[model samples]
Target chain A: MSDSETPQDLKTTPLTSEHEALGARMVPFAGYLMPVQYPSGILTEHTHTRDKAGLFDVSHMGQAWLKGPDHETTCRALEALVPADLISLEPGQQRYTQLLNDEGGIIDDLMVSRSAYPDTEGRLYLVVNASRKAIDFAHLNARLPDSVVVEELPQWALLALQGPRAESALQTIVPGVAELQFMQGAPFEFGGDQIYVTRSGYTGEDGYEIAVRNEMVQDLWRALLAHPDVLPIGLGARDSLRMEAGLSLYGHELDETVSPVEAGLLWSIQKHRRTEGGFPGAERIQREIAEGASRRIAGIKPEGRAPARDGTVIMAGGKEVGVITSGGFGPSAGGPVALGFVPPELAKPGQALELMVRGKPQPAQVIKLPFVAKSFKR
Target chain B: MSDVKYSKEHEWISVDGDIATIGITKHAAEQLGDLVFVELPAIGKTVAPGDETAVVESVKAASEVYAPLSGEVVEVNSVLEGEPGKVNEAPEGDGWFLKLKLSELSELDGLMDAAAYKAFVDEEG
Candidate 1:
């Protein structure tokens, strides 16, 4: 939350020159000079991805490895720090979880995966938020047992190919990625390098997130752009797509003050992790699972074309209840869409909400998530 | 008809007798990019210069369109309700947001002329 920094000095991603050549508007985000939009603008890029394919530069997110002697040792070791059923993770499987504080506040949410390669049995792969990566790494290292090792990989560039035609376009370059199911990952050869490819993404679309060597990533990016269905998307469209799809953003939906339950992320915690209780904040988490969280996240659709942005106050029965964490005009949703925390009692579908826009109350309703239906290849 | 004048807030005003037409400047539209929503003040609502008279929203963000001179709203381009893209297409012409019956005609002198506004945009950018 407050730990996130808007750094004065910005770092450039490996694909910075490519983005510049494409006439991208670069902005400082998470300490990186990243493209916020391209010449085509956010609306076109957002709708294009839904109609075809879009490539996103996500190399700013941290990639690392959690290593131990074997599967049980590594999985259980990680299980101690986070609430997830890592012990039962089959090879090539990936799970999304949050690193929680002792008080049940989410320090950071991340992706943890077990490699399918026969030689890499004890190692787990991790992809974390760009802004919280350093903090996550520090929190992880200071507590992890001496037996487990963390190897941060700053030399890798991650590219996400997302949308309905993502599979067709990706198969042309990286052939075996089509075989991977949702949340499954495997190492594949691209440009003579073994890149780890996962069938997962933030957009809630059927897509692949590839981790390629920083040296070879530009080539892969160029090759992907060459596809007829593919166009380079910027962070602007990326956020809109993910928001309309009802996915969470790091600083917006989560922070040290937020709990996974309050963020509506209870599904990420498996039954074993919920009941057995050994991780940090296990007591609080289990108690929330048994009792109830006072507030929870819900999809909010403002009635008219007007958009409600982050920090917009939410009202229920003429009394303030919560505030919108993320909001904007959703190109795909055909109007304004938002996500905000509200009392669990009032977080039901069709529940009416009053959003204070420009200091005036505007009508809204709690709709089910994914303002647009997600096309994930389940 | 008076010449089109620009405000520091990036809104433009052009007076024709008692009625003045208002819209966001081209530079402002370029900065906003792909407006998805346009909320105009009601036709009889009175506004003062520098007042937040309308709301404009792009796909990623939202911004306020301020009143350039004191007036009562006489008309608005309802076409924007169905086609907000027109603002991006021709921000200074067909994309005009509203027409106001002027209450203070001399207020137009305070805004910048085209050349000055262009220089101001350049300096700010």
Candidate 2:
């Protein structure tokens, strides 16, 4: 399709012009003008970030605040949808959770932060995926109590600085960033604009996600890129990185069709939330957690170098057990890796399996998730 | 150097002394987006034109490499096992897939020249 199409009409991030100047292969992602690859390509970008640092423009993701009179009401209203323990979230702490439909299927996986700012009414800041922003917002709005208000912060831009040297790189800009533990959020100022820095990211690295005003995002990008250890990363690298890290991409691993339990994200469900069973689909999720799901997410490593892709059939004992949800060459693992669902009995690590690729059954092994060990700085 | 023939699949082969050195062209690498892993053909495996000989996988997609000529793989680039991005970095140079002992040199006559391959790519685009 031509670039003139609505999705490809390509909403520019503040760094769009900068990306073009750097000769990035621009593509449409989540309604934004995003770099799918740079001159070095996804493989180089993927390996570089795993070994060093990669800067990403994630402005397409939605960031917003929930304003309410008290934390209890706010958390209760939020718990009506997500499985996270929003009520117990401490100041600066972040929780990774999903908004579930009534049927227990995932709508979106997001991060909810308990803001330290006492004056912020909702006391919570949220970051949701770009593709599901509208749906997530609408879902939140309709279910929220009158006392709690969800405000969409569309004027902000999100940037992810990820890799081994991410903390040191950010420490150069915000000196105390290293003190913030993983999944914690703090406010930092850059170029006289309010920037919210969070010590969490998708690349399974020690990094920070900086949220800034849309107008100042370009400057923030330039400032971060000025660091010698950082390189501009694209969605291509981002996908491999997340896949290698075994983090779930919203659409690929968690979606309206899959529940958190089946996606192997049961850890996101709080114990109290489980007992309370107030959130959408809590009944199904809790029962699955207790009784075990019929099928569970797994990591599949194909024997040959040929990578199995999404929709590839997973076979075991001569039967179609499940299907590959996401698969590709993992730059970090140094081979082809995949995420798929299989019968619980076959979900063990290193179980022999086969994937149907190109109509041929390729030998594979059912391995544990995060085919590569995660190196997140907790 | 310019005497080599190209295929619509973006493979190029140069013949010398009944042997052919084959590799993907730069355009193919660019089109593939990224080179993450390459499944090379086994040495001494016989392949006919259009037969699947190798597999090149990017982060987003996987593509099969077809044999451009009937031959047996004499030498596969073992170095690419660890550095597949070399294909994208230099598709026609250090990224050469393999050398084949040609079974029939006449197979080269059906492939396009560089100019023709470029035109074909343009038309496909």
Candidate 3:
């Protein structure tokens, strides 16, 4: 395949020109040409998001909707495929869920939201990772009932405004956004087009995601960048910020072999779903809930300046225990941070371990889930 | 005397008699964005050509800095241990990785000079 030989086939987002104008270093990510970093670099961009507002072009992610006759029709059809209790998700509210395979492994993690407006009663919004879009769409089509229609919205672009000042900055453009708490979504009017927005994000900060049509997205991007507190951030800073927050990326903390219970994401499954046991892999999930998983993911903090990269082996008393999944230098945390799988005994906050980096054992300890405090407004 | 020479691995060597100051070329520094950590070889540590002598880490990943010539490490840039951003700012001057006491001066014969190094970088790009 020419996928590796030629990057010319990589897709471009609505903000590609804007990123190029800002002197961003473009890299191919998930079959799309993306900005990895800008002129100011990842370090500054990371700290700025914590102190102020940072705008990110997330249009590369997949946006789609499940349409059925009513809320119950669509929710029940979705409930059969995923673990989360989507039926109880109130109007204008959003919940994080994972699509599971028959073995209970996470196929993809996505956000499910319902619009409060009566005009769009049958539609359920979903935003999934860019790399897994095709696979996820195929899975949805193959599994869902014929009554529910899967509609992929490629004409819309997504943008995330993240940080402490996110509220005030976004309130200036769409005044209704100020009232949204965490996990709440609604439709707002801008540039004669209705934009879908949610007060949620992956960066573990107070943020808002705006979904707008392609035509007005550039205008909206320019308007958001015009804010004094807002600066455009690239994927490099996004990764570091998420690392400090201890959030799991799809390929790292989640994959085909990683179950929801082992991935430490059982909290996303509500009590009703646990009791109902109607979804795929319900037997394994319910059993794991009753009996703990053999191994679980935990937060790892390397005890030195040198950051341990991924695939580094975890050792305990000269025995290999686990492997580091995702790791990097966290600019905002002012040190190195990582996440990995460990036994239940070693998953505690103060348990000590060693990471064999470059064949040399480096001391590390299991800390709390999030290296930094979550600053969500909710 | 153009005492400067460069390696295909993107390291620059400035010769002062038998001692040489070594660092990654500007092209290499630009490619590795915003270094966050640096681990240099200890003083007096001997290394052959192409040996791993240092480690430079960026925010998202880690990379190795290899020795370009056979030598013993006589001095290192200790300032990098505290602040690694200096390497991206001045990769050849203040950000120099180490100074080596040359053990095999003939190893320099296969290296490239200023003009040749420029052409090599362009062709590689």
Candidate 4:
């Protein structure tokens, strides 16, 4: 929802009191009173994350588990909804996938990790966008067989520690976290509490996303901040980070109207799934895969200081060709960067286009994705 | 400094003779947080009191700065184009957004002084 909306009845995360204590500028985001930035401001917070480590209280994201008698059954049930090859996902490994509608449109994009914990065998841990959590849960429950149950784990809070030094900062308190490679997760003990730690993040940096019980998250947050390199970042910097990393935000880059292929997420779909054509909208998606989609998401670099924000029209030869999905000033990139959907022919890196920003036709050019190179430790 | 007045919208105007210097209040800058860009009114443009004469944008959002009184814009700050953070650094002094030649001195009577503006902000809060 809009940030300007009244937050009278907005939900607060477990760290809400802590955020207020830290003098965070609280705003209405996805029905939650979330921090947009702290007193240090967005610029410093953003640069610090790129240089050091920034801790993000992402408790607003939806965490859950899907349970069945065995991994095979659970995976098959999930494969029916998504085009990812969940059956082959090795234990402790995570795969990024999307919940697809019948029309091949995206319901929501999510991270699915096969639980490596012995006690949680035959289960899949999922993290979905907060705004679409309810819709995603209902969609999963309605589609999965009676043998599979969807469990919404509302008792957990997700925290992300991101940057080049995130591992070192976290390894100080939670030893052996460095052993976990990118996209790998495992159970860990912190302060006598069992927490799920995943070596993954959206910032395109070497980081970890820790999921802890709500009761113990505050302690974990405090312990992480105790490190000199760790700073508490808000949603403002988080948006810029992900945007620079070329990650797709739910409503901005993806929606019910956009397909995964058009969003440039074809790599997420498995070749076997693509060939089998069993998932929803497989016919259309396969067709689009074989024949390129009309419009594809591409990176845009505006020529001037002003940003070409969301919904700004893209023009080629004075004719409207596309619209910007996500656009802003990237702190690390030190300029205005944007992501938008344009005709496949015009998606080339060197192709020139004009952005109609504030009624002015500003010169822009298509650029390679991930304006900043990814630094994820493989 | 005693000649400065504030608008309910959080704009500040300082009058010396017929020229008025205008900028946003510190409270406004703090609320906006981290100015990334500032679009100043064009020099030589005429503006009436309450007209949107400038725009201040932060990473989060953009807010319009309304004119405090009827005036003809005399000078616009171009330094903000290279470093908008000046608005957040020294909004009252070096961050002054524009200078205007007052067309109607009576418009100042409708504005609030520093004390009245502080009270107004507290009441709104």
Docking category of candidate 2: medium
Fraction of native contacts under 8 Å reproduced by each candidate: 0.91, 0.91, 0.95, 0.50
Ranking by DockQ: 3, 1, 4, 2
lDDT of all predictions, in order shown? 0.91, 0.87, 0.90, 0.92
Could you give candidate 1's per-residue lDDT for residues A6-102 as a string of tens digits? 5457788999999999999888888898988899999999999999999999999999999999999998888988888898889999999999898
For model 2 the local lDDT of residue A96 reads 96
lDDT per residue as tens, model 4, A38-110: 9999999999999999999999999999999999999999999999999898899999999999999999999
Model 3 achieves a DockQ score of 0.88
List the DockQ of the predictions in order.
0.83, 0.65, 0.88, 0.69
Structural similarity to truth (TM-score) of each candidate: 0.96, 0.90, 0.97, 0.98
DockQ winner: 3
In angstroms and one decimal each, the interface RMSD of every candidate reads 0.9, 1.5, 0.8, 1.0
Q: Give the best candidate by TM-score.
A: 4
Candidate 3, residue A18: lDDT? 94
- RMSD to the hidden true structure, all candidates: 2.2, 3.1, 1.8, 1.3
* Per-residue accuracy of model 2 over A1-378 as CA lDDT, tens digit each: 244547446678778889999999887777777888889888789888988899999988999898888788788888888888888888888999998999899999999998976576466899999989999999888888888888888888899999999989889987788988999988877877678899999987788899889888888889889999999999988988888878888878788978898999878887777888888887888898889988888988998777899899999999999999889988778788889889889999989999998889999997777766777777
Model 4 chain A lDDT-worst window of ten: A1-10
**How close is chain B to the truth by TM-score, in each candidate?**
0.96, 0.95, 0.96, 0.96
Error of model 1, residue A125, in angstroms: 0.7
- Candidate 3's displacement at residue A19, Å, is 1.4
Name the top lDDT candidate: 4
